[model samples]
Target: MTTEIHVTTLGHWSNSSAGPTTSFHLAADDAEVMLDVGVDPVGRLQAAGLSPTDVTHVYVSHLHSDHVGGFANFVFTRSLLNRAGDVPLLKLTIVGHPSVLAGLKELLRVQYPEREFDLAWVECGEEPVALGGQLTMRLVPTDHPVPCYGVVVETGRARIGFTADTGPVPSHQHDFAGCDVLIGEAFGLRGDVGESIHRRGHMTAEDLGELVAATRPKFVVPFHFGQEYADADKRAELLSACGAAEVTTVDPVDAKPVIIGG
Candidate 1:
């Protein structure tokens, strides 16, 4: 059996006409994982030719609305589908920091008090968590105003890293080192927005470039910017910053899967 991992960015912008927010769908062998349940995730998944029921795991980086606002909607949609006999209820495992999980649980309870879900919770810890088959994930703490975590997913044949929502955290270089693909946040251009970007706990293109330089990932996918950066010239500028670090930048706006292995 050949091992292949496909990473697709369902939503890439922080805020703008191009947003549902920051979300990604990763499929490998026996696992289908969602990096974040950004707003309108169900619609985004469907737009990407996928369904919420197909997801086996969801990893929440933080409790921010942009990252977790659609979580209840996803769960509710799945439950409704199962109730309507459109699909069978599958146990969905949610991986996140304890606080994040708690917040999600409360959100679900408040949003759907009349329903029950086949859900499992896993708290992010220092140890890597296996996601069945040959896939395993390690959640590393990231620098953010609120509790947030970056994730590294390893298949037998490939390793993918996600920086989540963060500022320039030097320690993350060691955690994301040797990744085949690194999906990083490029919220803006360095100095273009001054210290506001860092103050918000988000990285600029230059910050992401520094990370790419340190990690040396084979491919760096930049996302989580506004619509302004979606323009061809601005996009190129963003790519130039990261690419100058000697790493290839895969534009997440293309909505194409970045395939690894096989």
Candidate 2:
């Protein structure tokens, strides 16, 4: 069973990248899933040679606009883009925390009073939910300003962890222990900016580096970078702090899929 992970969008909210906001697409033998749906998620999927129906499940970390702004568009396309007859649209399941689930429904209800899609919402707790026979995922609370979670996805062959918009939390290392790939967020460098400037919201590059070093994932792909850590030199410095590990830096605009196992 092979696994393909694509970084659809590679920037934070304030980034000027050509593509949409930060999102990830995970394609495995068991299930096709999306990590987040940022702005222009449909466009991002098109760029990745996929359609709206290709994504069966979406795991939303939080209710930030940069992360879930494209959710309405995604549901609308999947609901209406199908055959205009008796054929039903594809079933799209959205998984998130209890708080996120409530906000999500209200967010969509405001735009779409008459819900036409066969959408399902699942609330994730401490227990892991089996999306497929070989795919299982669990959400762990992270240190963010709002209620946010860092997702851990485990496949038959590899385990992938995504630290979505989190501050320095030592427990995350244990949460995502022994992952094959860790997709972390580095908004900026820690020492570069004043320590007080980055507190409780996003992780700095240095902070992520230390976290990665503790977990020691096989590959570290950092995203959600800010202007301070956007340069190649700055990114390299961040990767260097992770000790000796394979680092694949995703481009801010367009990037090819990074296959973890085959």
Candidate 3:
């Protein structure tokens, strides 16, 4: 089983680059899975050379537009691209917290009132959903203002934990314990953050550092940046803080897809 993680970033700490916001393109050799459909997503994913026909699943992090805003376009694109004879349109599943169904669904219907495809709305709760091949995923509740979740993608060889939009509660991260790759959001200035910031659920670099120590991930990829920082130094600290453990930096926009386990 092989998995490819292509990250076409839109907006980051400072810039949006060529992509939309923070959507991810996770492809498992035979199947395609998209995480989050943030604003301008189809354009971004297409820009990355991937078409809607290739995507089979979409797991959203939250109700934020930047996360699930492109649901309609994704469906529309699939409708246009996968109309080959004898083959059904790609099956699309949209997963998200149950609390966000009204908002995300309303947006979807608004864009495509004629809902015209094989789509299923799975309110991601406790069941382990199979993502084809050797990949399986589970969405866990994270500490955010509204209902939000971080994804845990596991393969036979390794496991990857992605903290979408979370605060500092670390309680939700326990499921990620001992993962091979931990992708955490680093979205704030350390000393500069006001007292009210941490309470908002977006993890600061410091909070992520603490999480890395507690969770004991072999590798840490810090994502989601703050507007004030230009360098990756803040995210780099996860290396020193973790005592010689390997650390890789994922810029808001990276050209090549990252493969966790070869």
By lDDT, who's the top model here?
A: 1
Q: Give the range where candidate 1 is weakest over 10 consecutive residues by summed lDDT.
A: 80-89
Model 2 / residue 92 / CA error / Å: 0.8
lDDT of 2 by residue, 91-178 (tens): 7888989999898888888988877557788888767888767878899788888899889888777788898988788788799789
Every model's TM-score = 0.94, 0.88, 0.82
What candidate 3 gets wrong by more than 4 Å, as runs, is: 1-19, 84-88, 230-244
Which wins on lDDT, candidate 1 or candidate 3?
A: 1
Winning model by TM-score: 1
lDDT of 1 at 100: 86
**Mind giving the per-residue lDDT tens digits that candidate 1 earns over 23-129?**
99998887889999888889999999988887899999998888888999998887676576655667899998788899999999999998888899987775788
lDDT of 1: 0.86
Give the Cα lDDT of each candidate: 0.86, 0.74, 0.66
The candidates, ranked best first by lDDT, are: 1, 2, 3
- Please list the residue runs of candidate 2 whose C-alpha ends up more than 4 Å from where it truly belongs after superposition: 1-19, 84-88, 228-230, 239-243, 246-254
Q: Compared to the true structure, candidate 1 yields what TM-score?
A: 0.94
How far does residue 54 in candidate 3 sit from its true spot (Å)?
1.0
What's model 2's overall lDDT? 0.74
Checking candidate 1 for backbone clashes, the offending pairs are none
